[model samples]
Target: MTPDLIILADTVHTLDDRPHHEPIQAVAVSGGVVAAVGSRSDAQSWRQAGTRVVDLGTATLTPGLVDCHIHPVFGLDLTVGVDLSGAGTLEEVRALLRTEAANDGEWLRGWGLNPNAFGTTPMHRHALDDVSGGKPALVRLFDGHSALANSRALDRAGVHGPEEFDQASEVVCDGDGTPTGLLLEAAAMELVQRHMPQESFAERKARLAGLLRDFARSGLTGGHIMDHSEESTALLQALEADGELPLRLRTAPWCMPGSGEAQWKDMARSIGTGGRRWSIEAIKLFVDGTVDNGTAWLYEPDTLGQSTAAFWPRPEDYTAAVRYFASRGIPTATHAIGDAGVHHVLNALESLAETVPADVLRRTVHRIEHIESVPDQLVERFKDAGVVASMQPTHCTHYSLADHSDNWSTRLGPERADRAWRCRDLRDAGVTLGIGSDWPIAPYEPLPIIADSQLRRRSGHPEQQPIAPAQALTALQALEGYTSHAAKAAGLWDVSGSITVGKRADFTAFEMDPLTTAPDEFAASSVLGTFVDGEIQFMLERLG
Candidate 1:
């Protein structure tokens, strides 16, 4: 086949397991798949009159980076207001909220509010009331698992007191049973969210398109979306209608607590449904919530006695749900942060060995997202059961502290806190560990996330003490997390991941060698270009 394009880089890291004695220098693409990978002379032989050859001088090319866990569609709502991810203190949060409240709008909204900023103060409406100018205000916590609605907002939603939920959600009332304005989990947050002003479909579609382009520009060629809905599906389709998506998306629609066989069937039907660059191929479930918000299901209750319950009211039902999907050859990715949550998911997946056909079980891949603080016993079980560990290193580096002062650390106490984000341990145990930013919850930039995986702290902040130094990953492992392991996590290893003959022509070219550069230096380096399906999705003007 005549090649359509040829990408020549200074160093080409195929990252494939197959042994190759020759150093790869060029990759040829035809029909959106890698047609050849060899020396510069070999590429010249394949070059034709119509072929486009681009040389990236001194650039290092590798398999396109893929964030294994992200929520781009959900982020539209989660990031509706001023970004508070940078605020370090309660004063800083209030200052930002006040500035947002001053804007022209009937309601005040903000997101990425760190719970640690509240210090010992309770997450009450009173903190926001003074700054909201009596307007209904809602602020999403950085974890995306909870939100704090100001008094007016609570009254608007008619959340006057405690409420019951099928899932482990709460309205969080005070001693007198009055709502404190803290809403935990999706069910509770939806109560107030439904009342918030809705953005037009056109507006959301534009934002999503912009976000996906940003992903590509940051060196990502694909993402495993952890959340998907009908709206998201439609938005993706609309974006593709205008043009091809900048990055490939493997979406997993959510199957929540109140769902049953019928809902499971609906989600199964969604599988394999998507546009050219996006597809729904997996099911997303939640066993628990975030540790920072006191919603994670831990073996022992957190110091606040809040994170003891599973997101599903009946844990047995969750197991059955997994069996339902596994039997149909559908892969699942569960949001399980705490030890107990991870344990439950592992137990459910392991049960499939007895009930599911051996061939089907082998084909299906199950993943547990955010295994934040599991003990040694649970670490090996991942490899044993063949479960993928989809983790977010930034969740530890950006939110928690080494001294145990952060809310997540303090809640788990010293012992469990010391075990934070065991990336190295899991990898050492022979587990397929895929890393991500969990964007909108944390930053979506792949470079910083890959760096944080090795640094165990903010990449550029060398003065900041590492949260869990022992959990740091090697440079090669960190890159693999976003490449080979990411593909393995999504069950797409055969078609994607590494740069090799017969694989999809997706590649990320960096100005610096990611493997050899120091973590801090790599985090700041530029992405020369990103290609998906043999087409350049993002490239520096100079490169173009």
Candidate 2:
């Protein structure tokens, strides 16, 4: 039988997890699944009139990259406001905000304000007020762990001074006990965010479309969303219903600390798995905050750390939540960054391993997102418990400068800082590590991150030293993180992840072999094409 389509490439890394690698010259696709994979001659025999053939000469093909952690809806919303990503200084951030404020709007919103951009100068509400023109303005820090609100925004949110939170969140205050207009973590940030105007349904759909296109252009065929909102859920459903979704999406609705089993069952039934393209089979929980804001639940207090509280005011509630979800075959991805936070999660999983049924354990798929700082003992625990370590390589490159000078490194001091992002250790210990970009917090391209994962240095910043050079991974190992390991992490290994004959033909074609390319060249490499379910999703140009 003639195949529907044939793809020919100079080289193909199937990432099959075998002991040896083989050269794959062609792949035939029919009904969105790989029908055959062998030499170019085999595909030529199957070709006939009306069968489309795409030849990517000298280009390399691999299974499509999967970002195990991202917030597509939130990232899209960040782009609609003032993007402070490139603003190197606080003055530059203010200038950009001032320019955006000039437009007609009730409130001004912006994102990607890195506290590292401030240098020695402290961030205050007055700085944002100067550009707000008396309008309420809220600009989130790049990490999404904190935000800066102007005086008007603070007043509107009814935040006059420091407010206590059940979680580790905080409303920043001055020496005089006056509100500083900065809110740390979701609990506090939502106080001001609730006052902002809501996005219309049409606007949400447009943003979703824009986000998916961006993902395709970046060589992503699918992603796992870390958090979900009602608006995001509806928008994804609306787009898929309209046959407009371009990438596969699986999401986790946020599960707070105090929520009981009843609430968990309700969320699971109402929002889980809308269709093949959209799913909400997991729940996202925050065990602790980020390192930058000093909110991480550390083993020892950070150097002058302001927060050492767990995200859940009650730690037992977190264990119960995990148990409740795992019992019903739902996964829980806890945002655990600090060593203490990671330990808390590991303890719970270790305890539950004995009681949960083996089949349920296999299907439960519990994972820890951003295991930023962990000891050797916990790395082994991850392997023993069969938990996936969903990590972002760019977190080290984009946030920590070598020599331990960056905010993230400085917070932990030399001893603990050296253990930043134990990617190599985790992989060596047989823990499945899945890579992602954590978009909006960091750049969301797999190529640059792959380069960073291998090199342990920022792509363009050659002057900055490598962070934890010992944690660097091999190119093949890194590729597996996005392909095979990522699929295993998302519980979709049986159907996706590799270019095997029976698997779906989801692939990312590159202009060159990322595994063999020079570090500098690899970071700058562009995608030749992206395919999902045997259909071309994005292509640079037609090949003869």
Candidate 3:
């Protein structure tokens, strides 16, 4: 069959394990799959008259990059206001809030509120009240597990005092039982969130389409969407109706605490359901929340005595849920951040061998996300249980400090803080470590993420000290986290990980060779182009 498209580059890191003497310089695509991969001469001979050829002079090509975890649909809501990710102090946060409050909106909203900005000050509505202009305001913390609502917003939501929740959520009240306007976890946040104005379906669909295109522009050819909903499904369908998606998406709908076997069955049926470029393939569960927010499930309590509880009211129920899905041959990715959470998830997955057939168990792939801090004992267990570690390196580099001054480090204390993001340890233990952006929690640029994995600090901020420097990954290993390892995390290694023949014709072309360039330089480099299913999704004007 004649090739439909051909891409030529000075360097192509196929990342294919099989040894080959000749360097790979060209790849030919036919019907959305790789047809040939060899030297440039070999590619020229295979190309037919109608084949479209792209010669990215001096660019480096690799298997399409995939963010192992992201929340695009959830982000549409989470990222709805002023971006406070850069605010460094309480005054800075207040200043930003004041500016947004001055706008004409009925409700003042913001997101990516870094906890460290509060410093010694407690997270209370009082902090935002003075800047809120008497209007209801809600600002989501950077963790995505908590939010700070002003008194007006709390009052609007009718949350006057403490509230009971099935999961480990909190409405955070003071000594007199007066709500502090701090909401923790999803249920607690929803109290005020439900009162906020909603975006129209068309507006949401347009925002999502723009977001996906931005993702592809950053060299992402695919993403493992950690959260999915009916609205997200419909939005993707609507976007596809206009044309093909900029990137391939593998979605995992959430299964929250109160859900039962009936819901589990319904989610199981959703697997393999999607359009040409998007599909529901896994289940997203949470054993615990974020460490910075004091909702993480730690074996020992933090200094504040918080984070000792699981997200599930009954821990055993989580095990049952996992067993239910594993028995049906569906994979699960649990948000387990602390030692206790990671340990519990591993235990649940390990127990499957006893209940499930050995063959079926062997095929099941369970993943633990945001392994923020875990002891050495839990490191090897990922490989032992045949589980993958889907982590976000930027969560460490951008959020924590080496001096143990940041909220995440201060809460965990010295011993646990020392174990922050054990990326190298897990990889050395023969565990498949897939890295991602976890966007809305952190930035989604793959280059910066790859660089941070090596630097153990923000890619461009060399002045910042490295957090857990020993945990840093090599450049090649870091790149694999978004390529080979990412595909393995989703159980799609056979067809999508590497730039090998017969794999999907997806590619990310970089202006420079990622492996050879310095970390800082690489982070600032441009993505020459990105191709999905052999179709160009984005290309720099210079290249075009």
lDDT of 2 by residue, 1-544 (tens): 6688999998988877654334688989888888888778878798989999999988999999988888888776565588887888878998999999999899988888878888867788988898987789999888888998999998899998888877778888999888888788888999988888887889878877877888998899999998887777788878888874677888888998767878888877855656767788689998999888888998889997554788898988999888877877888899999999999999988778766788888876789999888888888899888889999988988888778877788888898888999999999999889999988788888899998998899886678688889999999988899999999998878889998878988999998798899776888988888898888888985642
Residue 299 lDDT (model 3): 95
Give the whole-model CA lDDT for all candidates, comma-separated.
Answer: 0.93, 0.86, 0.93
TM, every model: 0.99, 0.96, 0.99
What is the C-alpha lDDT profile of model 1 across 1-544, one tens digit per residue? Answer: 6999999998999999888778898999999999989988898899999999989989999999999989999999999988998888899999999999999998999999999888998888999999998899999999898999999999899889999998999989899999989999999999999998899999999898899989999999999998888899899989989999999999998888888999899889889989998999999999999887888999999998879989999999999999999999999999999899999999999989899999999999999999899999999898999999999999999999999998999999999999999999999999999999899899899999999999999999999999889989999999999999999998989998999899999999999999999999999999999999999999999989
What value of lDDT does candidate 3 attain over all alpha carbons? Answer: 0.93
> Alpha carbon lDDT of residue 536, candidate 1?
95
Q: Which stretches of candidate 2 lie above 4 Å from their native place? A: 18-22, 270-272, 542-544
Give the better candidate number (1 or 2) by TM-score. Answer: 1
Model 3 TM-score is 0.99
Clashes of each: 0, 0, 0
